[model samples]
Target chain A: MGVIHVTDRQGQRHTLECVEGWRVMEIIRDWGLPIEGVCGGACECATCHVFIAKDWVEKLDPATDEEEDQLDTVITHPTSRLSCQIIWTPDLDGLELTLAPANG
Target chain B: MTDNIETDVVIIGAGPVGLFAVFELGLLDIKCHLIDILPKVGGQCAELYPEKPIYDIPGFPMVTGQGLVDNLLAQIEPFHPTFHFNEMVESVEPIGTPEAPLFRVRTAEDGTTFTCKAIIIAAGGGSFQPKKPPMENIEAYEGTGVFYAVRHMQMFRDKRVLIVGGGDSALDWTVNLQPIVKRLTLLHRRDAFRAAPHTVEKMRALVAGGDMDLHLGQVTHLKGKAPVLEGVEIKKDDGSIVSVDCDVVLPFFGLTMKLGPIANWGLNLHENLIPVDTEKFETNVPGVFAIGDINTYPGKLKLILSGFHEGALAAQKVHRYVYPDKKLLFQYTTSSTSLQKKLGVTA
Candidate 1:
């Protein structure tokens, strides 16, 4: 099992165990983080938006068109991505990201 | 204000679970009227991801979100369940005793009232409201200089307006309101838009013709005082901060679910979900029931299948409250001709 680091809205960093094939959203939500993941990984809702660390942004696959469409619905950063779109794998070990502010 | 309508059951949502509850309750001769805040039924399935495929539904290996909702609507068609669309339940007053429960449910839009013996809240993740932007103090300008939804276009006539977002609402309003507003500006995070191509084309034509403004940025601050007119500060993608003077700002981000008036209904809420008995799925209130994602139990799984089971069991107990003196018998639709007749299917 690999591990992923997530920063909550409160700016507290938490390291969570990552299971293979699980979305980063599932990992953050399983660990009881404040990520909404409202659409349950369908990538329909942008509630699970996160900002990937600048260095780690290039390691992951680019966000798909469908993911970009959802991201357009919310305030996004250059590194912003829907955590549900980032499937966990061995290569993604040590990934770090911060939760986006909760949209009102 | 119209005459208060009387029904045996008033379902507070028209989602898949609420639609299924109509089928379960119908088998026991319980009539139902459903109310929803959305203009159409299907709740999250229709609103959030109608095109997304779902594979967990029984019998069907895979179906789109809207597909399941359509089938559920067809499944309960025989019951002829009445639906009140574009309405929200504002208040639920218990008008009867604990033994024989009765409630007067009122809606916000039209103030329609329904007196029912059983109330089923199948609201999945609560009511969907407009998703506000993350700007601080934006709430202070709500309904004044800032509006999430445009109820009256005349209110914006001759006013400087700033519309934010790349979606249809923003694009549509930008195109439609430009002709009326003194000056209109559309602010988006990126140059690309997810709205309809034709609408985007229209907005581009307006921008090209110098009829309005298009800025590639996000709103960073609201310059207006509480419920007053002013402008906004936008942070451009190029790290430049720009200010736009406007009388009104309309941000059409999207919709998010929130536990609205349900929190004031006096039911015991645990983290926005109503605690229900595993056996009946009824809320703390005797006649009021909570099913689907809105209700929590010992091992409640917020799956469509789990909600179907909850609706079926809840309907059984609801039959007890609706028809206290009538004896209920368990029967199967495959063998029981009486049950088959209720389903409108018989040899």
Candidate 2:
């Protein structure tokens, strides 16, 4: 199990807990945070874009090719990552990230 | 029965983008009637990914695709947008001239018609058609013994039914029809299912209880006469052919999106998407606005939030065509009393 802190676009923090093998997007969405994940978890729509907290960026699994391709079309930053690409693991507990701007 | 209706604007495709279009157009005092091939609203969000969370809708940080659709529906409820469900908009004809035009939209399933001042093509990637399994005689048996979609559950009562596919539809029908059908069998290439985990677990319980049979194989052949399917031949993983006796075959291979009747609407198309100007999102044809994923423009993004923006901009332009004499002054929802009154939040 792991705990994740998600900072939404409104600067509100949502803390959620989940067992391993859950997608970070699923965790945030289940908690009723702001993420559209329009293509579900297909890594197609970039609505699940999230900015990883600097400290936890290196600890998560690297994004796959498809996830990177989808991120290329959206606004990106140094810590940007698609939440669907990050599956939860106990080793990476205490993960923190911020939801990105949708289409502002 | 033929029903003739008149509206200020007729929005096609009742997805998130189309639902939001009603709100934007409603703000301009323009009434709308929405049509979708799906039986219900919330196209992809409701159909493909109802449970998936969407991160990028401006105000709320995260809402499920279906949740956003629900909120959009509630937001547009005050406007009272009319909805025509389970009907495909088959033809769009310019009854009036190029400059001051009126549109006559006709549906395929029922001969219902809508005459409108403007048309908003909010169809996301157009109509959805189910992908059929690779069986040579499948088409011949369609509507007789083989079916793609179940329109009526009573038609399947007490019959030996064979359902193919591993998606939500297959599992859903398996659970729903278990009590009605005389015997039911679910066949897939593997034991894995793409349905909800709880649903998958429930189906497994039913299978273990001998309530239904779960087979692992592909339907390689259909055994039936012309227009009358009798059974199917399955090729098991071990390379042996097993024949399952059944009166009906329902293949739920999922759906494919296509640019159906809108392709013949005389609008200029860039590839498969309707090309539109970024300002008003008007198609090459005047008085016809194409928003959502069905439209393409410079720096066009297919996200639902982007479509909402396009709907807002297009509504501004639609106001001109809908009410040419009135001058449209933009009003913010936060301060405009008239807007708040329309939203029923004026207290």
Candidate 3:
């Protein structure tokens, strides 16, 4: 079990009790904070954009190049990342992520 | 700055059906103002499958969804119709005589109000929007990596792209992204595709090509973290569980559309759709015409070709009713070219 800290674009922090190996998008969508995973956690739609916690950024794995290219097209901050690419592990118990409005 | 601009006609919803009205009316030398909630034109055709192929629309043998939009935009450009993008009509009330009742159309954007002699509701079945996945905590990976539609296919290029759903949207994307994305995985909860046979054939070919993987089952379990989509657990029909390391996941399940602001007008709407139709496309209220998906005509087909036919026909009918003094020109055909050309020529 992993307890990830997710913050919406509005700076609202959600204490998500997520299952290990579950994608981060699964956590936010279940809480119902208005993050439309239009693609349902696929890297195609890019509606599930979020910013990772700066402190824990080093601890997280780097995004693949393709995921990076997709991120450029979406309306997001420099720290933005697509949530579907992220998996839940017990390691980063306090991971912060912020919401960004969809590019549509 | 002006609250309203007076025109001979007002078209709500600047989608393909709405723009088609402008193009058709332009041919008749009729001026109209088009309104929609989108920031620009193209509507659903542009939004849904800009890169995907569309076979239903007539002409050119075949064309991409965006290609159809391009052709439509070209046709409507000559008319120089006024467009109020990102604006929606709150309500359309009729005012004046039977020959030409001036319409009081309220718009929320810019707070500008429009009053036209006639209103043509060329809004399609509705504006299409990406549907959200039902999974909890799905939004947590917002920027990280989650998607609905393929707004940017190149981004997933040279990477593992995992897609869910056995429908047309899913299969079509799988076929398109096969060459771009390094590896593609097609997951369907069913044994067969609901899409036409031709598309399924294309997908099967791709799977056989070895560039794509076909996982026939449900994603019963998901495994991931802050930076990597290391693996996913798929629940197979045979009770076997498979885990995959995916770089990206694209779900093309389906689309959800809204009835625009017309839903709030309170005009005896049937399920927020199905407005009462009197003749052709006229709604329960006079001077207020509902065309395309927004209207429940006796036997209206929801196809773009059909919607365009209904909308164009409704516009012409309204034109005659609005301007009794004007003479009707051109012998328009009510039967679809597909029907007429096929049934008449073939039969």
Give the best candidate by lDDT. Answer: 1
| CAPRI-style docking class of model 1 based on DockQ | medium
Q: What's model 3's lDDT at B293?
A: 61
Give a tens-digit lDDT track for model 3, residues B1-347.
65668887888877778888886666555788988777778776676557767677877678886888788888677678998887777777667775556778888757788878778776665655555544434565444456776877888888888888766777788888888987889887556676678888999987787868998666654457744555567777676889877877676655555666777654667755656454557666556677666677566566778767776666676777557688966643354453333223333
How many angstroms is the interface RMSD of candidate 2? 14.5
Q: Each candidate: how many clashes?
A: 0, 12, 48
Q: Write the per-residue lDDT of candidate 2 for residues A1-104, one digit (tens) a residue.
A: 56988888789887898768988899888888878775567876667889999998889778776566555434355677998888888876888899987632
lDDT of 1 by residue, B1-347 (tens): 47599999999989999999999999999999999999999999899889889899999999998999999999998899999998999999999998999999999988989999999999999998999878888889998888999999999999999999999999989988999999999999889998899999999999999999999988888996778959999889998999999999999988999889999999999988999998999999999999999999888788999999999999999999999999999888779988888888875
TM-score of chain B of 3: 0.58
lDDT of 2 by residue, B136-221 (tens): 66789888888888989999999999998777888899999888999999987665677799999999999999999998777778
The stretch of ten residues in a row with the least summed lDDT in candidate 2 chain B is B128-137
Considering the true interface contacts (CA pairs under 8 Å between chains A and B), give the fraction that model 3 also has: 0.00
TM-score of 2: 0.72
Which candidate wins on DockQ?
1
Against the native complex, each candidate's DockQ, computed on alpha carbons, is 0.74, 0.03, 0.02
TM-score of 3: 0.48
lDDT of 3 by residue, A1-104 (tens): 66777776576777888878878888778877777665456465566778776787777788876466455334234466888888878887778777765433
How close to the true structure is residue B17 of candidate 3, measured as C-alpha lDDT? 83
Those runs of model 1 whose alpha carbons end farther than 4 Å from true positions after fitting are B345-347
What is the TM-score (0 to 1) of chain A in model 2? 0.94
